[model samples]
Target: MGLLDNLKAKLNPAKDKVSGLAQQHGDKIQHGLDKAAKVVDEKTKGKYSDKIQTGTGKAKGAMDRLAHKDGTDAGGATDTPPAPPPPSSPPPAS
Candidate 1:
């Protein structure tokens, strides 16, 4: 294999492990990101609120992609919609 191919092969396992961890801990990771953003915003006295919000959104988007929570299939298309809730049972007669 070429140097790039060899490097990719060596890193593939680590990448997979990281992806799995991201999927498992996605909620916690997102919470941490929000908390950190809040702390930074507070420290800066809201001076960079807009910038911080933008960065935080981008970070969350990246996390979702990493965790496969972005609704994208293996083909990279998001054509599938979320499943609907089951119908509720009818009320009993009086």
Candidate 2:
């Protein structure tokens, strides 16, 4: 195998391990992200609230994508169904 192919072969196991860890500890990772964001926001005295929010959202989106929560299966096909919307119209006035 060539240099790039050999490197990929060696890194494949590590990649799988990282994916598994990301799936297993995703919640804890997200919580840590939130806590860190809160501390930074407080330290900045809310001056960068919008930027902080945007960064936090992007981080969470990346985490979700890493965890494969975007509905794509291992085969890269979307095997999950879309989420249902919330109910509307307050029980039709009873």
Candidate 3:
């Protein structure tokens, strides 16, 4: 096996364990993220409020993805389909 493949195989178990833990404690993890963001925002006196907010959002999204809350397929890409756009009017009868 390739070096990367071997490394991935060895890490799979730990990754699974962490994924399970993330799913179980996602709320707590998000809370901690929020708390940390708040502290950092305060420390920066809102200088980077937008950037911090963006970063926090990205972190939470990553955590959700790791926890499989985003319905990812085996390839780790989201399997969920985008919502269909609303029709402006009913389609004309054929």
Candidate 4:
């Protein structure tokens, strides 16, 4: 395996654990993000409100991706698993 591949393999377990945690505590994590952003915005006297909002949105998006709640795979595909085909009707007897 290449260097990047080796690194990814080593980090896979940690990544899974983090994803699980994110999924479990997503609401709490998002609340914290909003709280921090609000505080920073207030501290800056709303001068960076837009920037703060953008950053917060990006961070939330990343969290959703990590939790696989964005309905996308690693390749960014939104394709869901194919459903089973319906059973065919039997032919009439001769």
1-94 in candidate 1: lDDT tens per residue? 8999999999989988988999999889878977887777777777677777778877877777777776878787765443322222333344
Report lDDT (Cα) of residue 80, candidate 2.
54
For residue 90, what is the lDDT in candidate 1? 30
Off by over 4 Å in 3: 79-94
Q: What tens-digit string does per-residue lDDT give for candidate 2 at 1-94?
A: 8999999999989877877888999889878877777777667776676677677777876666667776776676766543322122112221
Ranking by lDDT: 3, 4, 1, 2
* Clash count, predicted structure 2: 0
Provide the lowest-lDDT 10-residue window in model 4. Answer: 82-91
lDDT of the structure predicted as candidate 2: 0.69
Per-residue lDDT for 1-94 in model 4, tens only? 9999999999999999999999999999888988887777767777677777778877887887788887887688755432222222233244
Candidate 1 lDDT for residue 30: 78
Candidate 1, lDDT over the whole model: 0.73
TM-scores for candidates 1 onward, in order = 0.74, 0.67, 0.80, 0.80
Selected candidate, larger TM-score, 2 vs 3: 3
Model 3 weakest lDDT span, ten residues long: 82-91
After the best TM-score superposition of candidate 4, give how far the Cα of residue 48 lies from its true spot, in angstroms. Answer: 0.3
